[model samples]
Target: MMGGELKRMDLTMCTTTHDPAPLSVEECERARLARDPAYDGRFFTCVQTTGIYCRPICPARPPKPENVTYCTTAAAAELSGYRPCLRCRPETAPFSPAWNGSQTTVARALRLIEDGALDGPGASVDGLADRLGVGARQLSRLFRKHAGATPLQVARTVRVQRAKRLLDDTDLSMTEIADQAGFGSLRRFNTVFAEVYHRPPSDYRNRKRKGRGSPTGHRALNPEPLRV
Candidate 1:
């Protein structure tokens, strides 16, 4: 009886290990090199030269194999000290399956976040839960488990992207941009943008132009806040 129990346990462990989730580092590199959109949400790739990481389908030229490192999540990469890519906008990329792999509630929460639900004035977990037909506590649990970011962190990231887009694309005043980008104030917007992107909005815009006049005398697209 003891022997049979031990065999069953070993078999169960083997099955569990063999049936593990689909996460591929080599596959991620192949997808990055191929610029395959199918794997965009599945993995992130970091370029050693730039210190910035991007989704697999980014339009920028592919880095050499020796120059790339695969990252499982944007947060993981950020935690490892990589900055988000200006070209790919990892924040705006589709939510990872890991975020929704276990719970429908967390998945929906992420979708809502992408839609700018939590960005504007007075957005709250209670209101977010009411819309999702779930409780605040449950929503928090999902964010903690999958996103590696609190609900507020997710929302704030989205807002920063919005601000960055405005800063780079339009000559909007900081105050106007802040309001349109869903920030409570220009100070907050500037602070957050500087923190995440490592440059003030003005500095980012200048660097993007590099003192060259715009081709059409109009601002260039940031390409970072791609919504489509």
Candidate 2:
């Protein structure tokens, strides 16, 4: 073990070696220099010179290793007050954790939601936080720092994405889609889906399977919440 036990990364405060232990510094640096897509989302390259962070595959000119610091997540970098790269959009990086350590709060919350923690009419942020052993307010703060959305907003995005998939690949009706997507009512679903994607839910029904994305070519879930 290179350092001590892992703990919550208080990225909202500071970035230093004394903060929670990070991934292998040597490995993160090598991957950044290589411009390796394989390392994308595993870690981020935070440049002190530019006060910006980027994906490993970011096409912009690479910063000197001395001017760079590695962060395990976009939220960490952002919470530490670094902006996300305009070209790479670290928020949208594909996630694939290379370490076998504890999952970050974001990762765990996402896992729980994917496993149906946020499903059904009874699901709520307080319930999810209880499962994660954190308070609702704290969990929401973590999400907003890292995810650029509140826990409910994250769940709403998940529902909309699920509904979009159902619309594209399945023959489900509007009511069915709303119910399956975990909205309290079909009317609520329509209103939220339109607000987020700027299109009514029915507008996407039976849509072609090709090039599935928003007008900006980003996924409906992330919605270009670029924290730049």
Candidate 3:
């Protein structure tokens, strides 16, 4: 768990409607190398060599600092074309509630997105914005500025990351996994999984099973809110 003081600081940083005082590249690099838990959800380390992004607390050997870039959010890293690191699954990292500053509409929108509000049938950006009392265009701009991805992009990443966890931890069939992950069809699920992970779902599952002796522990896609 993060200390209350750091959580408060993160909230302050994220609440500003404009750009906040983001961690410097040098500071991020130091945190990544140090595996600092305090910085875990503050920024993600994307390795240029592997094209993978990981939580700062990732247990895999740290890559060379020169090959690393940092993103303010996992969504930002994914938008930059980096895949989540399998070893230190970014999906399992604690969600920073600070990202939802009380003043920003984007913060409320993000909470809805994380709760599968966008995964249901007939959900659309326009509808989501209407629910939040904003126009779709304004919502899109807010997402681009704060999350570094479109609403649809963030939703898709959330689904895919959830599916990845299911593949790793559950014995469910592919169809069931797809359904549970909120992918409307197995074809869509397969396409997105391959696009992000560079392999078919079954191949990833088989490889993971062979590598590990037991199922990896399951962590909910959304962690408990930051202790304020």
Name the candidate that leads on lDDT: 3
lDDT of each residue in 1-228, candidate 2, tens digit only: 112211223323334443353456666667777887767767777787778889988899888866777677677778777888989888774544423112387779987886668878678888998988888888887787777877676777788888888887787889998988888799999998888767777764523332365576655443333121
| Model 2 spans with C-alpha error above 4 angstroms | 1-103, 206-228
- What tens digits encode model 1's per-residue C-alpha lDDT throughout 66-162? 6666655677667766788888788666565533444777777888887878767788878998898877887788779877889888888888888
Q: What are the models' TM-scores?
A: 0.47, 0.45, 0.49
- Residue 224, candidate 3: C-alpha displacement in angstroms: 34
For model 2, which pairs clash?
none
lDDT of 3 by residue, 19-64 (tens): 3556656676778888999887777777888888899999999998
- Pick by TM-score: which candidate is best? 3
lDDT of 2 at 188: 91
Q: Flag the better candidate by lDDT, 2 or 3.
A: 3
Provide the overall lDDT of each model, using Cα atoms, as 2-decimal numbers. Answer: 0.71, 0.71, 0.75
Measured on C-alpha atoms, candidate 3 has an lDDT of: 0.75
> Candidate 2's C-alpha lDDT?
0.71
